[model samples]
Target: MLLAYIDEIGQTGAFVSPTHARFSDSPAFGYGGFVIPAEAAREFGAYFNKQKRTLFKNEIPEGTDPNRWEKKGSDLLFARVSDDRPQNLRVFRSLISKLDALNGKLFYYAAEKPCGTPKETNTGPREFEAREENAMRETLNRLARHADSGKQQIMVMMDQINEKSRKQRLPVMYAHILGRATEHEDMRRIVEPPMHIDSSLSANIQFADWVCALVKRSIEYQLVPTSRYSWIPKETQLLRDKEIFTFESKLHLFHRAVDDICHSRILLEYRPVIDPLHTSTMNEENRKNLSESGKLHSVNKLEQPTNHAKAP
Candidate 1:
């Protein structure tokens, strides 16, 4: 069996730019972390717990139980994104090595937000039952593929959320876990319903938070040069690290393991491009579908939104 520990890596809501006043926090939103053998999970969790205590003793909160207390991944990344100092870098690199030793690898799948203005469809009320349902299905399809390739059952675990928010996502979960697959492979490879574990109880879950934080921050740094974090060699007060990659650009290198684990293996769902001003890249099919007058392509029969709908 394969154990996949994952957490939300980025915001799923509207993001016009890094500097957008109302919606500027993240350029992407999806899930990420690491996957390892089931038998190795306990060992990895123990290692993670030791590292968290050793590296973040001061930030572990005053009154909380050490075992139950958790360090937020965003906070850890904020403290360690600087690439000049090697201490923190060594720590993160060591963690990476630990995971690698277990045959685990980093993995992430994200939806690149439509850059520029984001607006609701001007047509009737709404076309889909849930707005981000496609994104969720895309995530599951990727997971299913990952599990199938390894020929092992994968059990996905994510950090717990609030009751109200959790309740809202239940429908999406039910559709994927209990519902059948249409057009795509049924997620029988994945042993769902996914477990939602508290980060405090599971060191692996906490480590997942860190992995996801790195992914989120790295993407932000790439999308916005002005982003305060750096995977490059530089002087930042909080965390200067000896470094993971020595090149000027580490996104390609960093994503190498990531793609092998899942990215390159993905069969993407067709999504209608929404860039009204045409500032982003478009594939050949999308370009060919464009009208002679250069307007956005109309949704054809095969291209209809219902084509991407979940199984009934």
Candidate 2:
């Protein structure tokens, strides 16, 4: 019964940006995926609350903000930091520290390109369909490999986007993944949500909070230097899609248990820097900086109008 609840944060459609050299019409998009074990949900709530108290002792004070007090009791905390250099450096460092304490792993994937771009020879609906299918396949393939060896069942729940549309599409996506699994054969079950919850509160907020934590952790992981001892390669994209499915399935249940108690709103408070030019370190010429030729061009060059299909 390992279940993985999945949700995406960030806009998926078009955006307006005039300064770029390439596709002037498209928007920048990002994607994320998070997982946790079913049994650890409660423990995470308790531990998260304690960490909140430690981080924002001054903000909590004695008895001023009822919401703060309520959050403490509820075991919820939210915080955000921008992508600015020193600030992100500190924030990401702290995030890694918290992740170390939780002993869980986070995996994320993101890709951005111009909107209205067609895939293959498809146009409109067909194009969108192909792109979505490809994205789903890529994500599933990457995630499914993280599952534990003994488990063959993997349930995946995603935030229902128009209930009807998602309901119809999710099963298809599930089936598609299963079909793809023929090559691996380890995956046995696939589940999608609105899975039941016994708690009085909505799982959306809890899931949202969890997403915030994951986003912070992911950003931090990307920003900070990795040590062989501290890094969890298992959590990274090394495993097959079947394995990742197990990991995500377990996380789904874990989030449900903590949804009621955790302070999910903390994610809203986080100030994420949107500038692609920003770097994690203060060093002007650090090769790791986002401004480096390799990194920036990888994302930016993809947007060039020269790459666009010529109009008939």
Output the number of the TM-score-best candidate.
Answer: 1
Residue lDDT tens for model 1, 1-312? 888787886665666676678777676667777788899999988887787678768777788777677878776667344544445556776787787778776667665554544564221213222434555565566666667667878888888888887787767776776665554554787777567888888888888888777767656654554666644223221221222210111122222222111231121111112222231466667666664433343223213333222221
Clashing pairs in 1: 83-241, 84-240, 84-241, 85-240, 85-241, 86-242
True-structure RMSD, every candidate: 11.9, 13.8
**How well is each residue in 119-191 modelled by candidate 2, as lDDT tens digits?**
4223455544554555455455544554434354545545445667666666767687667667765443444
Q: What lDDT score belongs to each candidate, Candidate 1 first? A: 0.59, 0.37
| TM-score of each predicted structure versus truth | 0.67, 0.46
Superposed on all Cα atoms, model 2 deviates from the true structure by an RMSD in Å of 13.8
Residue 55, candidate 2: alpha-carbon lDDT: 52
Model 2, which residues run further than 4 Å from truth? 1-3, 15-31, 46-99, 115-126, 148-154, 189-312
